[model samples]
Target: MRRTILSSILVMLAGFAHAQTPECDRLCSRDFMFSLDSGLDVMPLVADGEHANGHMEDGRTPLIWAALDPDDEDAIVFTSTLLFAGGDVFAQDSKRGMTPLHWHLFRVGGPMKEVVAMYLGEGASVISKDNFGYSVLDIVNGVATAELYEVYELPYVNDEVADMIRGWAELEERWKDAFGMHLGRDPTSVRYFEVLAEEGYIPAMYAYASVLEKPKVEGFTPDIEQALYWYEEAASVGEVNSIFHVGSSAYSGTDTIEQNDAMAHEWLSLGARHGDTNSQSLLGLMYANGKGVERDIQKGLMWMIISLRFGEDTPDRVRLIDEMSSALSYQEVKEAEQMAKDCIINFFEHC
Candidate 1:
């Protein structure tokens, strides 16, 4: 095993050595793209100073290429790796003068907010514009519609991407309006949210469903049917919170939602992989108790440890930890802990 591991390391080092150039054009090389798409560590290619920010012939950096493909299964992993390796989030392509964030918004999609948030967190400027004078906010706030697309001579946007951008803007507006109304104690806040939810705004669907599930206001009764409907709706769109709610409800068999351990396992697995701590905790319980799936103590304990690391501690959680810890051998506990650490490092994708 040691020999095999050493051989693998040597092979990777050989490839990395072959890929590097003195001038550092590795970021845009075909080999680099292959490495990124294959989930090989491209960090080696960028580890040398300034290579992470290097551009191609078209003046597009690796980050820009990654941003252009939000739909790719490997995009997020590659994008995050590039960012971690110090890819300049503000790097603008030569032709479009669009930053990574701007290029991200210029695509056709159903909101890549996680990727957008990552760029924003790294200080990507939202006000930055393209050569056509369109800001990131302009595209995302509904200002860059089909009419403006024509006016700006952005023929590359086409009808589909323009419609998607318009939809994104509408969703943003609905989210802001609904949030403001709710905070201001407006009586029609729920109705407003319901309208947005019906329009397929995911956050509104979750909010509306939450209100129906448990009415904090006086004079409103619980509507289990509508709550479950919206919860399921939002979950279908990969809304993490709604996925947790639906999974939890399905596991515990709510008034309207039936008890189906299989459905609970499926949904909670999705939620857990999306980094929902509650989902992780519940999935741990499921694995530990063999509730919906086969029992696996180490897998269960790993998730419990992960949940405790990322979430606030509770009495039930502590007790579960103690119980699971007592049941596992020392080696089992150590392995489980290592698994939890790796799971977190991989952004829960491997978990």
Candidate 2:
């Protein structure tokens, strides 16, 4: 799924570059030029030192051209060969001042992930911007959407590319400070999350809220009000975990906040509708017990079954399922199963 989206974006970027094949210069061989132009595996040809570092009339080196090729597999070998033969990793085109690393980011192959990493390993600069003042990070951030970032949910993104983006973000002290505490588990750097949260960084908002709600560091006490405030801030930005946490809090009630079943139902219903299984399970329990809304065992069973389908099987869910199943008639169970299936297929609309 991610690869498909990435390929579409890369095609657009490749078109944006609109590069024409360059006439081979005095330094480049026709054979080597053909190898690059045809997107062939370049290892065997570039192994010799003759044309490895050769450039075209546009000042684009063999390395830069390798980066622009649409085929990811051959591009990797092509990049590796040229770099091994001492191709300039920092080589930029005369027209745009874009580095090989920059062009490589637009390559369509998913495996080209390796090429990006290789550039970084060879000390290609992420800070290097093109003529448009767009750094490698800028290009990535501008192209990648929330769906891309949520792939594995590390910090800014999920995969190796995400680590690269985080490295770029770390160039700023505030990000470094926040990530240092959040990821490094350094209690002393906790305040940095507040700094970033104040700046409206959504992840930092979630982190800050968690710390306030349940401080692990010494010399800190839980502050439900502030915690709820930050959680609300993150929730406003569509941070699903924050939505779940807020619902969980309202359901159980904290030191200063009174239990409000209606508010709990409202928040949890929203979270459940958003496909949060935790919310689904809790909402199911509420419906089963008639704590907030009127009791409807079939709806409760539907939610519980759907939660188990999408989320991990917790002891609570397992035990609840067993109890609910035993009490439900066989027809009720089948009806609930069908309802869960419909809810999933219809994306929770009217579920």
Models 1 onward score TM values of 0.52, 0.50
Q: Give the per-residue lDDT digits (tens) of candidate 1, residues 80-173.
A: 5445323566677776677876765544444455665555434355555777787766765555564543434322444554455555565666
lDDT of 2 by residue, 32-103 (tens): 334344533332232222333455455555455554455546445544533422356666666667777666
Q: Could you tell me the TM-score of candidate 2? A: 0.50
Give me the candidate number with maximum TM-score: 1
Distance from true position, residue 326, model 1, in Å? 5.4
> Which pairs of residues collide in model 2?
none
Residue pairs in clash, model 1? none
Give the 10-residue window scoring lowest on summed lDDT in candidate 1: 1-10
